[model samples]
Target: MGRNRKWIQICILLAVVILGGWTIASSVLDKTEIPKVGSKAPEFTLTGLDGKTHQLSDYKGKTVVVNFWATYCPPCREEMPDIQKQAAKWADKDVVVLGVNVAESKVTAKNFVDQLGVTFPILLDSKDKIRREYGVLNYPTTVFVKPDGKIAVIKEGLMDEAYLDRTIASVAAAGNGNK
Candidate 1:
């Protein structure tokens, strides 16, 4: 009986070790790390509301603002005008703003943008692929990609006009140095 008990304990201990190792390995392998500053932003191809396909690689020489938002998010809605203003402000400066609507239908996104008078191209993430790729679990997340195809900043909340202006300027400056 004592030997049988010892063998059972050993088997349980071995099982625990194996399971623990598997858990750690799986977490390390499947971890979704947010793009770090100076890392290349994850590339994605999404269809904009205008029925045009927009790909990150297509805007190679431009600084890109990739903002992930949902129509139901109040902060995201509040920042639309400022984002539109920023898009216009940098239009001539080789900057592009890409608003990605998270898991929302085209009509919903279009209606919200139209109501806010936002003119920037809005992409539809029907499957939430881009949102997961960028590790954006919150609304109003903005990722700034410099002209060199590197991420400059990852902001996860509402951005005021001043913050947007300064962020764009900083990215522009970084791009200038790279050029």
Candidate 2:
């Protein structure tokens, strides 16, 4: 009975070490540093749902909102309508909302956007390279870039219309007094 108890304790110890090691490794690997505010927005050229190529550099003089999302994320679904509203509200104001679908099929993204009536340009990050470039570790991350092409805000998780408007206003007021 003593020998069996000793073996059980050894097994428990092994399990703890393995679990601890995995936790440490996962945290280290999963952490991709998000871009600092005020840093130059990383340049990316992605194909929109419209099949037209959209480049971040092309929208240089506009307030750009880049939102990274996946179809399976519940928070992403909840925030879609608000983002659509903001997109329309700021459409004439030179503020462009770019919906970047991370690692989701075009069909899935298209259907999801269509259901939400999202009019903003939907860009496909098929390879998830752009997500990595932005260091987005969470779904529904929104990076607001100024007209001068610098990141003004990095919001993780759900972003509401009020926050969207506020960030846009904040970015517009920053760097050379851009609208």
Whole-model alpha-carbon lDDT for candidate 1: 0.93
Q: What is the C-alpha lDDT of each candidate?
A: 0.93, 0.90
- Clashes found in each candidate (C-alpha, N, C closer than 3 A): 0, 0
Compute the lDDT of residue 100 as modeled in candidate 1. 95
What stretches of model 1 exceed 4 Å from their correct place?
Answer: 1-32
Best by TM-score: 1
- Top candidate, metric lDDT: 1
